[model samples]
Target: MLLEIAIGDAYGAGFEFCGREKIMRSNTLESYVPHELGIQAGCYTDDTQMSIAVAEVLLANSDYSSDAFADAYVRCYKRDQRQGYAKGLQGLLDLCVNGADLRQRISPESRRNGAAMRSVPLGLIADKNVLAQAASEQAMVTHNTAEGILSSHVVALMSHALLYDKAKLVELPDFILEITGFILRGDWAAEVECDALQTLHAVNTALQANRCMSTLLLDCVNFGGDVDSVAAIAMGLASLTPEYVVDIPASLVNGLEAGKFGSSYLRKLDVALAGRYPVLSAHLVRQS
Candidate 1:
């Protein structure tokens, strides 16, 4: 789970964040960039940033508290202007700023990508039940819509399983199906106003290669809408089965700038994980 978060953070910072300049680039150029630059340079989007927010909340409480989670979110949004925050998240922050009932204010009205992006952190910090609660509360605060909450909730619960439940990763499809089945059975599935289904469908198909990172990139990008969220989920899946993640490409791992955006903090995380589990560092070193 920790390793997954680190990779998600790296991808978020490397690819998603840097791609902002691409809006002005030619369509042809835009198409060529990802393949040329690779996913390593692909920074994370609102997804990883929100995950960071969740992690901050967990660190403070060592558990999931809806109130504390909401507070941390507001703080993260305000602190990181470059968090790739969108309007939906901004609204949640607004409600938080106004001291609104976060649980009630955030409802099924939001069918946006906000929920799925940040939910991964909760997945890592808590168990499935707590993860589901955190995802639901966070979603309800701004995205009252059923799809919105499901998007985040399903992914968060899956992430939790991936990180803590070793048995789950071995049967990836069953795990994804478990979450999807819950979403399908939930009230959120009744309100099908958004393209979230498309994203979920894509995710379902992509999980077939549930053991391969390259397969995730293909499925995530090619599967169409909500590539960032799709990729984020894929990252969660891949993190669950790191044995299949392969080594980080030399080019992507080499030119990383480690002095910015608490890059050192990320390294510290890496060191901690490595020290506690020498095999991880050994794997990384071998990959290097």
Candidate 2:
């Protein structure tokens, strides 16, 4: 799942801020294209970096610790700050590095996709009942707004559900709407829709049209705002389906940036977690 998320993030990184019309004008969306960063075509952004950080903390602690996760985020940022991290997240990570209280440092009013981007790991590692709580706890490390937390929860829950029940994907949009509506009731319900909801709505539209998974991924990335995060969350759900798994190109997986905590580290975490959880091991075997 982390690999899929990273691949999606990398694929979309090049088109992050491009308009939908420009992306649609491209000849082929199957292969990666280099973004303005001057990095390689398949290099992932802070989305995968922060997600790997979360997975590392989860694998090391046997339980979620906000401080440890914050430390991991700081460490990853220090290792590579060129992964296009949002200014708000960079500020929070700086505070974490300086030993500040992370909870207090959170940007409660800013509703960026940082939380949703990295929250998939919690979904993979946690059970359904505890998934939302874990997502909120991790999200609150940087994004404390109701919108941010709820969006993260929606991604986490949807990822978990998709992993176990790929057949339920047809109902994903309604599932997202139902869950988001329940979370943001009354006054909050009338607020503007968050990026996570917009992503899911796009997914619902694509599913209804019977589009190919690759096209759906392209559409998600081309939605314009928070492209990498939205595509990561959407791709994480889409990747669980057998058809979509085949749609992921070999170049994307082979092209992930490599280092101490890069693609190799993600694989190690996946194997370790799968070993501890037989169900995940079986799922991995099926994927292989």
Candidate 3:
């Protein structure tokens, strides 16, 4: 899940800034290089950066604590602005700087992908209930919309389901549906069930995050409509598979600048966590 989070963070940024025309015209996922898209490689958005913050908190606390997660987030934001921030992210940053309770800052007011983008890491450490709680808390800091919280919860649960069970691979859709049903049943103040279902539909029709690592990885490479969020969710879910660990692709991998701290950190994280990947493989799909 960590490796997927890393690579998805790296690759998803290409689509965040590119229009649909360029996305459709691109021949492969590799074609959307940071430079071609006018962004730099190894420059991840807030999704992966915030995820690392969550991981850091989990690593030290060994338990779920919303305050701890928020503090870690503030620390990261203070350190790096290039963390692929979302709409209204600055307000949350400001609140943190003012020593405000993170809980007070977050409410269901808007449905940005911010919460969902950084949700995978929490799934790695907690069970479904705890994962949902942590995901909610993480987003509550700034994302106040029902859609925002639902997206985060969905990603965390899906990732948790994927990571914890190996034998249930064949029942992926059922699991998604079941979890989706469970979440939608809660009183979230808005009908974000539709939005969550749309994302699930994208994952199902375009990127199958449950069947195989290769399937989900390839799906992420081609999926549109908040591709980073889709890719992040897919990677998070896919990373749960013991066989689906992510490794940097070699061709573009070598071009990564080592001097940049983000690049260096990702490289080290790859070395520590990524699996041995194929040299170069054909993209499974073309941009639509």
Report the number of the highest-TM-score candidate: 2
Shift in Å, residue 129, candidate 3? 2.6
Tens-digit lDDT track of model 1 for 78-101: 665443445665566665662235
Off by over 4 Å in 2: 20-22, 25-27, 37-39, 91-106, 165-167, 173-196, 203-212, 243-245, 286-288
Backbone Cα, N, C clashes tallied per candidate: 24, 0, 10
Which 10 residues in a row give candidate 1 its minimum summed lDDT? 185-194
**Which candidate has the top score in lDDT?**
2
1-288, model 3: which lDDT tens digit per residue? 444565565666666545557556652545225635445764556767777787666656555566677787777777765645555665667566632454566554656666776776665643577777787777766565677777777766665665555424445656756776632221122211214445544544433333454445445545554566556566655555544434445533444335444556654543433222111011111100
Model 2 vs. true fold: TM: 0.81
* TM-score against native, each model: 0.67, 0.81, 0.73
> Would you give me the overall lDDT of model 1?
0.51
Q: Residue 210 CA error for candidate 2 (Å)?
A: 5.5
User: Candidate 1: lDDT of 255?
Assistant: 37
**Residue 232: error of model 1 in Å?**
2.2
- 34, model 3: CA deviation in Å? 2.6
| Candidate 2 C-alpha lDDT tens digits along 108-202 | 56576667778776767546656776777777777778867777787776666666655465566566666667332111111112355454445
